[model samples]
Target chain A: MLDYKLLHALATVVECDGFERAGDVLGLSQSAVSQRIKSLEVRLGQPVLIRHPHLAPTPAGQRLLTHYQQVQLLERDLRGSLPTLDDQAPRLRIAINADSLVTWWAEAVATICQEEGLLLDLVIEDQDVGLKRLRDGDVAACLCATPQPIAGARSVALGEMHYHPLATPTYIERYFPEGPCKASFQSAPAIVFGPHDQLQHRFLAQCGYHGHFPYHLCPSSEGFVRLAAAGIGYGMMPQLQVGELMASGQLASVAPGHFLAVPLYWHFWRHSGQLIQRLTQHLSRVMT
Target chain B: MLDYKLLHALATVVECDGFERAGDVLGLSQSAVSQRIKSLEVRLGQPVLIRHPHLAPTPAGQRLLTHYQQVQLLERDLRGSLPTLDDQAPRLRIAINADSLVTWWAEAVATICQEEGLLLDLVIEDQDVGLKRLRDGDVAACLCATPQPIAGARSVALGEMHYHPLATPTYIERYFPEGPCKASFQSAPAIVFGPHDQLQHRFLAQCGYHGHFPYHLCPSSEGFVRLAAAGIGYGMMPQLQVGELMASGQLASVAPGHFLAVPLYWHFWRHSGQLIQRLTQHLSRVMT
Candidate 1:
């Protein structure tokens, strides 16, 4: 059996990103926090953290952290059954893609969270990489493009998020005067969400343009759409996010028929508590 | 003088987060990219990269990268005068806080971007830590709470962002039936943006509450507002973001008169090109 107090100190250190901040949160001195970490390392006979350039957990440290988080979830379940436990609400950390959060995710989970008296810690990542958060045990659940679940985890298919290569009417008239073609695509600028986002690259490939093209990288979902609408660049806009804009003629598809349908999946621990299970079921129903 | 080609390789490696991807983007073989990095390091007589765990630049590498990016900016300015230079639009990377991005940022720079035929790479970061991006050579400019600029950079005041502790009427009725007091604040849930966000803690301190309180950690600016309006938790809502909601009677101030005024500043290199200077002037005029 492991000492939960020591594990908690490790978790807090990672969560706070420093021993000093962890001490502030845990109501202990910085040296005391350091002492606890040292004691845990002494017990385990290995270092759990890489303390130089940046504070990150080692592989062994990650496994222990994941175990601690899972135990915390089970304890929350136990607290639910026993009304004598403190009435503090439990927080569920989820790694979700930005497009989902900007469109359907908040509304889908809002009711359940409010009813269950649950709190959330939402970490936004690109769909292509969100699964890593689940795999690393950094989050209880995640929404990603990948359907495969890691060990001790389950994945459920959510519906596809259709993306259209969209731009303002003025932008289209200026850049693609003869309509979208290989030549036009090579010249016209495009908006990419970030380095991790491959939607535009894939969409362009589907349009038969594999050559290098210029692009603006905007990390914010709202800002990406706004840039496209302001004639800064055309981009692959998610259907759920741009439906109203498309209807209002604010944005028009640069490629009329060609679209990318990215399939989303919900991944969570197989042995998660009832709240997570319920939330998973609810998302599977409404998301599709 | 350092070879721009080698510096370009270094920048591409960091940008892509891997050598293979950087090779693909640079149209070089993986070994060629590796050779370029090695040659650059040999010339410098020190290691530029820390390859294990993660790919990050050493201090010397960061200095070289910053110098390379500044030269790129100057070359872009030179291209404007030369006109015969390939007509690729210059891309300016800026680090901005989510609140500013969500509210005032895009609109402030949209016209300038469109007119200048410039593209943007906007990196979203918390205001408290955004200046680090600028200092680390990751961004050409940054919007942050810090008033002082780093060496070779300039800082301009951009006015204050007022944050009010806001909650729905029903949430207030349930959590603080009488009125907001230390006891209510102790038990009631709060919405914090992330670990770096201290607005709520500062606001609570001002309200005469210095005890530990439960909070939901939300990293997205739009989602944070949604969570607050959904009645998940009361949070320090930015005045620019919640004005419409507050006026429509959806969100109300919990403490009535109390608010947090976080002063914002724009930090950029002192020797930037005309485009950056124009942007600085534009932001100063409108953001205030």
Candidate 2:
């Protein structure tokens, strides 16, 4: 029930960071772009953008952009299927987290892109926030940690991302020679992915360390593992990644029988596109 | 010219998400926390908190939080140096990008943390934005790409992170048998790190492909290289990382002689702490 042109104008203004630049991209005059955004705002009866600090969309504006992106995706998909339309390759926008992108997901996605002659635009975010991007319509599909499906969306369980408390043998010997007790756990530092990443906190809380503890925040999975291997801090590591280190005695388990298993899901908008179907099939087949 | 206590109150409220919870964390009543925030808002003569769409700090609020965090870091460092200070290890926050973290940076950092009995809180962001954290006082120091130093900061040129456009030979033959041209560049997919990452764009622009092109976004350096090796897409890779692979013929340069040499600098507050000095010395010695 909204105008695609107006919605695009709004999204482009945010993306371009100025009306003049958005105009250049959309082939409209600066005033025309401004007027289109103004018209859209009037239609919605609310402001869609915050003008200062940076050109960013308001919640309502984000919702509108999401709608626009969804419509654009479906239309593009439809156009790709109709042989009479054009031979232009279709671009597929996807939302994913850093962890999945680095591990098993990238290979599967790249193979598909090459074979199908599809263009992929990947929006990388934390798994916790990946689904929010999907809800906002910033990306047509997302791989996230949330197991529950959003309304009018389809979700497929991609199995658990198992994490165990791992530390270098030297770090364990230096900090927890008596094993990982509450006392040593408090004194020893832990590595965290980011402020929002609660993997270490969850594991510690499960191990009964409820109070504030020292931590080193390494925001990348590979970097975090490298730090853990170098005796910087004890933190959780995925089973697949830590197995070799554990076997080689470079890294050791902090606590026996205590692990955090984060369940992951792939969520996509309710659509009937062959590409989406094939992508889903390919992911489900390979991820498990 | 701002009260650190009030700023702390505001930051805690934003971090904790509710007045009651923030009050619990600060050991104050909910009304006290609210009154402190109100007083601070009055002092600033601007609304600092957004009451709707979940609790978020306004631009002004974010600025105050940055100041508060900076003050907190200095105070903690000061206390750690005092003879009366407790034996608890101090946390040192820093800003860096993913590539540095995954490569040579992590080892040196972990060694410093282990030796100094300090906790590192690394804020990972692109080199372009890494200095912003230093200005905002979110981190005491940052590893960034900016050659010019901010006010009251000292910069040390470490080295250049040289990147070359790399891809598998098979992909090169299939996509660009005629060699690198604007047409082949348009049709062939390129791997990008993230939406914010412009390495590929810079390279393409250098190669005369000024328009938009198909791309696969792989957020990790390691994963990006994996995709390139698997013939998913040609992307920029650091020379140090791709050297072995290139030697083995698993990967080859897309366009020889065309590379991006990103000069990296270490920027830090003009502080005289032995720990900061030692850290800087250690990093310069290792990275250079």
- What TM-score would every model get versus the actual structure? 0.94, 0.89
Estimate, for each residue in A1-288, the C-alpha lDDT of model 2 and write its tens digit. 667889889977875567987887688999999999999889989989877544678889988977776666666677766768766666667777666766666677767777778777666676756787777776778888888878878999887778889998888888998887888877888888865677887887897777777788777788888889878889988886678888999988888788998887899988736677788988899877
lDDT of 2 at A88: 62
In order, candidate lDDTs are 0.86, 0.79
- Which stretches in model 1 have alpha-carbon errors above 4 Å? A86-88
What residue pairs are clashing in model 2? none
The alpha-carbon RMSD values of the candidates against the true structure, listed in the order shown, are: 2.2, 3.2
Q: Lowest lDDT 10-mer window, candidate 1 chain A?
A: A52-61
The candidate scoring highest on TM-score is 1
Across B136-155, the per-residue lDDT of candidate 1 in tens digits comes to: 88789999888989998999
What is each candidate's DockQ, to 2 decimals? 0.61, 0.56
